[model samples]
Target: MNSSRRLVVAVAMSAAFALCLPFTANAGHDDNGTDPDNRSQAVKGFNLTANGTKAMNHGKSQLERSVITTSWGGGDIEVYDKDYGDNGWHGYADCTDWNALWTSCDIIRVRFNQYSYKTSSQWKSLGCHEFGHTADLGHRARSNDTDNNSCMREEIWPLYYDQHDLNAIKAGT
Candidate 1:
């Protein structure tokens, strides 16, 4: 083929490949435990105070009601509550172990900071957000949520997952 024809073909192929790729809002956030196989797994909590236990239980309940099918025991995911003392984050999730292929997580850890006092609703929101991370759900900015109601947002305003978050969890887990 002529040089110009080859260039045109290359451009066309590139565009096609790009179109075939899946789009994820939480693209780069999938590094730790964002494995799909973690769906329907069990989670446990450690070092939890009364409030911390409440938050963990709320998060676990949300996950169980969602399409993820997560249960409240068995150590697949370990949740912890401790005082971080103004670390600028309310909670976080990390994968402690991975599957053989590294595509899925064998064990995950979720932690909640007890430095600041939060309302019951806020605690639930934190729980939902951190747990959402284990199910491959990423943080959703306020701008992305038109209705302004999702636990995945950086702020702890919403106490439950919005439809979009639920949909993402369904697709991911």
Candidate 2:
């Protein structure tokens, strides 16, 4: 059983790797067209290229474990880096305005900003955090009495989320 599971994981990983191909040269950006930082509504889908693809490949298992492949409107999130030619985990995720990538692919890539301020520790958790978003898991509560520190928002410093955020992710907010 363990062997079969490993085989399955390996195959899945391979397929995921295959998917990463054919998009590195052209995976685009808004190019200062519109800043997603202003939108509260779910951002659209896009592609993850080269290093972004590699980062997702590195963390794809975690994302798959968190239900990365689901038929929902959660949207696509392209993972990427400013310098795909370089070798490093940019450590970020963002959704571009990509509705044509795929209808179900609302959040296409789980991006990584190569020059981000995030460290390894933060990137590790960021991968999970974006996975949560892909799974429709938003931030969780950060109070003293809830399931704190186990989710994206809680993990974010400066207390990005409160009880409502927790309730949202848990309750699909």
Candidate 3:
């Protein structure tokens, strides 16, 4: 091809490549950031029901296996199972305290609603969802997930993080 043709082809290929690249922006809400120290998070449970305990354990395990580092001890993140009847929420996560720079969360709180009447698998899904939030992840819609397979969805489904979630976490923390 002529030099002019080659240049045009190269520019087109670069644009296409850039368009195909996955979104690398952090998926989590900007209000909370990863743990300030070493980007590792420590999770603990409090006054949890039997189901709640199981859920919390599942969440911790999943987080540990993901790109976001997590441990079973320490109180960097606190999980609680409560009976919030018909409040229209299965679970939620919040940053109770912020680091000195206000960029990361010093303490995060995760809560599960027992009134949701979820099955064991559903509880596990909830665990994964809430834990994602504590990691600064926002809710993902089913339409947004190409495979429709992510616990980060607003509803309780899937038991683990998807590649998109991992990529977002990696980019964020």
Candidate 4:
């Protein structure tokens, strides 16, 4: 029985690794055209939206815990199933505006294709990455600085907001 359990665990781990290998190998950013800066903002208040994809849903909780809890002026971050009709400021699973900034995140899409190909953790990390953009964070452009664990990094995984990310939040406030 112990041997059988071990086999099951190994199989599960292997599957997870396989699902994530492609992403790690090609961890490129969508590049929404913003330069990295330490401009922190207090985020007076904003109504954000997200699609109902599994990854987006999971990401919503993570963002709320890590990012929203620190920023956001006590407003609701709406999660919906439909895409933004006018593109004023919303998040979608299929949005092409990855990490886009237009008058404050007209949308925060997570690239729906990721939901089918990547693991929940990967999508969650990407979600945080997009949210980082909402906080006015650009991609981490420093190449030699391998110590960067910021979600703003072009590659998403082992997700967590670094101190620089926190500083970005404090830039405009």
Candidate 5:
């Protein structure tokens, strides 16, 4: 395989190992920053409903509402929003985390940054993106300084959603 592809595999492996499949999840609720919610947080996954899956099959769209009851360390997820805590956390207006909750039997949650119903492909891709983090996958290291426009990275994450992204999720992280 080419060096870049090898790097891809290496990155995936590194993230998986970093977790050690431990437990411990964090809470959050910065409103936009880090406002401290003092509630609870968990991520839920449901097999796409018949309609949802049908939409995907027909090139339509679908997205389930995910609530993030933030309360504490903002938990492990990085809460990002110019209006709340840091102006540019997590590279956008979303708090995302690569939490290893298996050992502790906890769960990490991610609050979708925006509300939009794009094509099913897009929504599915977004699921792939967030789920990737749930599985411990992170953006690929940058070619230049630490700023790659790659999908794993934030800059071009909205551009294209490829199979490698799916693979990363499958392989864990």
Candidate 6:
């Protein structure tokens, strides 16, 4: 092939490969900035709020647990319940609201269902998944059941925050 033609072909192939790359299954209310240049919050904090009757129960507790455990003293992290109103809290189960600002990637709010759709364990994993997003984690493609250990995986099961997930959060920050 001609050099010019080869270069064009190579560029096309690279683009194709990038497009094929796996991404996390995320539901957001606004643009979740993927560009590192656009975000800056190094440490993330969560303000667990209630959605009216959505009391703070085991599901919320588990989500908080995931946040604390995965962070591993990454930085200033907070999880509080009961009197905190839904002022800036985002979604955890029903809907998620986020905006990757130039100053911080930390989540502004989290909204979570009381795990009415699945078992407690399943929601616990799901909670991790949602919090992972707050940590600026995207969906990752799993290679095996072991990969399911990552809270960043698109599939919510075998919920455990893997090194990859932690790294992603740190990188974003």
CA lDDT, every model vs. true structure: 0.78, 0.43, 0.78, 0.45, 0.35, 0.44
Better of 1 and 6 by TM-score: 1
Clashes counted in candidate 5 amount to: 16
Tens digits of lDDT, candidate 6, 2-120: 99999999999999999999654332211254222233223233454433212223323333433333322223222333333444432342112233434343333334543244455
As a whole number from 0 to 100, the lDDT of residue 82 in candidate 5 is 20
Better of 2 and 4 by lDDT: 4
lDDT-wise, the better of 2 and 5 is 2
What are the RMSDs of all candidates, in order?
Answer: 3.3, 19.3, 7.3, 18.2, 15.1, 9.4
Please identify model 2 stretches exceeding 4 Å from their true place. 1-55, 68-77, 83-107, 144-147, 154-173
Better of 4 and 6 by lDDT: 4
Q: After superposition, how far is residue 136 of candidate 5 from its true place, in Å?
A: 1.7
> Which runs of model 1 end up more than 4 angstroms from their true locations?
1-33
User: Which portions of model 4 miss their true places by more than 4 Å?
Assistant: 1-54, 57-111
For model 6 the local lDDT of residue 126 reads 58
lDDT for each residue of candidate 4 in 39-101, tens digit (9 for 90 to 100): 221222122323234444444444454434433332223233333355532333222232343
Q: For residues 11-114, write the lDDT of model 1, one tens digit per residue.
A: 99999999999665453233335565656778787868888888888888878767877766656789888888899988988888888887778787889998
Which pairs clash in model 3? Answer: none
Q: Whole-model lDDT for model 1 versus the true structure?
A: 0.78
Q: Is candidate 3 or candidate 4 better by lDDT?
A: 3
What is the RMSD, in Å, between candidate 2 and the native fold over all Cα?
Answer: 19.3
TM-score of each: 0.81, 0.39, 0.77, 0.43, 0.33, 0.43
What is the number of backbone collisions in each predicted candidate, taken in the order shown? 0, 19, 0, 12, 16, 10
lDDT of 6: 0.44
